[model samples]
Target: MASDQPRIDFSGGAVGYRFRRSGERGHPLVRAAGIKRDHMPSIVDATAGLGRDAFLLASAGAMVTLIERSTEVHALLKDALARAAMESPELAEVVGRMTLVHGDARYLLPELKPDVVIVDPMHPPRRNTALVKKEMRQLSSIVGADEDAAELMRIALATARERVVLKWPLRAAPLLEAPKPSHQYAGKTVRYEVFVTALKPHVK
Candidate 1:
C-alpha cells in the first residue's frame, strides 16, 4: 500500500480526523502556540511535514505559513489544500489562512518574521527499531535524518518575534544544543516545547 499510502488529505482520513477535533483552544499545539479566542499568533511551521500542524493552527484561527523543503511533500500539501478548499466554505476559510512556501526555512525564516515559529524537524528513526508509521517511512525515504535540527531551532529562535515551539515525542531528551524550552505542553504521546525568545511578546 505504499503507492496507495495515506497522503495529506484534508477532506478525509487521519489528517482529516485530527482536523475535525481542532478547536481554537484546548489542544496542546494550540496552547503551545498561544492560540486564544482573541490572540491567534501568526505562526510559521518551519518543517511543514504533510502540513498537518499548520492546517490545525489555521483551523484555530492563526494565519500560518508552511515551509517545506521537499518538493514532493510540498506538492502533496498544495494539491490537498486545493482539493479541500472546494469541499465547503468552512474548509475554504481555514485553507485560505494557510500559505505554503517551498524552500529551506533557515533562509526563509528571517523574511517571514512570524510571531511564532514551530519546528518539528525529522529525527533519525530510533536505532534498531522499525519505523512502523507509514508517514515516517515516507519521510525517511525522502529526507532521511534531519542532521540540522539544532541549527534550525537556532534560526527559528532568532527569527520568531514571540516564541518558538518544538514538537517532540514524549519522554525523549530535549535538544542539548538549543536553549532549553521555557516550558512544555505534554499530551499522551507527544509534547510541544515552547521557547520564549522574545523579551516582549507581540500584542495587538
Candidate 2:
C-alpha cells in the first residue's frame, strides 16, 4: 500500500465521526431514494466505493446491497463494515441492513432485481483540484474513472423496479448518454438525479 492510499476505516477516525454525527435521520438521499415508513426500498448501490452512501441509507432503514466491482475496494469495504458493525449496538444494527457483493453491477443488477439502484460513478476529475479532498483524490487513484458510467445508468434504469438515483457533481453537466432525470435533489457539492422507471407507479 502507498502512503497516499486512503484507509477504509469506518469504525474510527473521520468516517466514523461523520456517520455518528449524521445518525439514522433522513438526509437528501432518503428523499432521493424515496425512503418512507410505508416504503422501505431495497436498494442496490451499484458503484459502492467506500459505501458511505449505502451506510447512510441502511442507517435510515432501507435494506441496501452494496456492489463494488474493484476487488481491493470490495475487500476494504468488507473489512470496514465488519469492524464498524462490532464497534457498537447502533452500528451493528445499521450494518445488519447492508449487504456487500463483489461484482460488476452491470452483470448483477438483473439478478438482484432491486426496487431502486444507486449509480454514483466517480465524477471526472474537477478542474479545480483544490476543492477535492485528499481522501477522495487517493480513492480516485484506486478506482480510476468510471468510463462506462453512462452504460451503467442505462442498465440501472432498465433494471430498477422503481427508480435510479444518480449521485453526481452538482456543477457538472448531466450524462448526455443517459435519459433525463425525472427529479433532482441538489446539495451543496453533489446532487442526486433520479430517473423513475417505466415499470409501474412507485409503491406508496
Candidate 3:
C-alpha cells in the first residue's frame, strides 16, 4: 500500500529495515562523511532528497542542515522528521539535530558556514528502470536531473570549511574536477567523493 504521509519511521518499513541491518558505526555513509566519536562535523546536505543520508548523519551525532529546493520533497522530509520525532525518544534526539531548510542551496550556502557540505544530486535515469525503487522513480520523474549540480558543488567547495563530499553512482564521472587531491570511499553500488577544501586553518 502507498503511504499518504511522508515518514522517516526508523521503527518500521524500509527505513527501519535499513537502520537495523546496517551497522551504524561502520556504515560507509558515516565513514564517507568523516563522522567520528569525538568530532561530529556540522553538515549541510545540499540536495536533501529523501533525507536518508541527513538522518544517518544526525543519528551519528552530527548537526545536519538539510536544504531541499523542491517543495514536494521538502514537505515529505518535514513530515517525516515530525513523525519520527513524535514516535520515539531516540529518533526525537536525532530529529533535534536536523534543521530543515526550504530553498535552493546555491542561494543559502553563502550564509551557512558548515564544516562539511554534502551533495547527493539526482542521477540520470538508468536503462533498467525496474531496478530503481518506486519512490525514487517518482522523485526523479518529478524533479528531473540536477543540471546545476556542478554549480552547486562549486559553491559548496567555496563555502565548506573542512571538505565537500559528493555521492554519485559507482561508475559515473564526477560533476567537477578537484582542485586538490581527493579521496574516494566506495560502497557496493555507490561511492562518495571527498574533496578536502581546507579553506579554514583549523579544518584539520
User: Candidate 1 — what's its lDDT?
Assistant: 0.83
For model 2, what is the error of residue 173's alpha carbon versus the real structure, in angstroms, after optimal superposition?
0.7
Off by over 4 Å in 3: 1-9, 18-22, 127-131, 200-204
Sorted on lDDT, best first, the list reads: 2, 1, 3
Candidate 2: tens digits of C-alpha lDDT, residues 1-204? 657666676677655776778754657777999898788989999999878889889978889999998888898899889998888998899899999999999999989989999999988665544524666787788889889998888889879988999999888988855468888998777899989884545642
Who is ahead in TM-score, 2 or 3?
2
Clashes of each: 0, 0, 0
Q: Which lDDT values do the candidates have, in the order given? A: 0.83, 0.85, 0.81
- Looking at model 3, the pairs that clash are none
Q: Give the TM-score of each candidate.
A: 0.89, 0.89, 0.88
58-170: candidate 1 lDDT, tens digit per residue: 98889999998988888888989999999989889999999999999999999989999999977545433342376677766776678888898999998898899999887
lDDT of 3 by residue, 53-139 (tens): 888888778899999988887887888888888887877888899999999999899999888999998876544444245666777
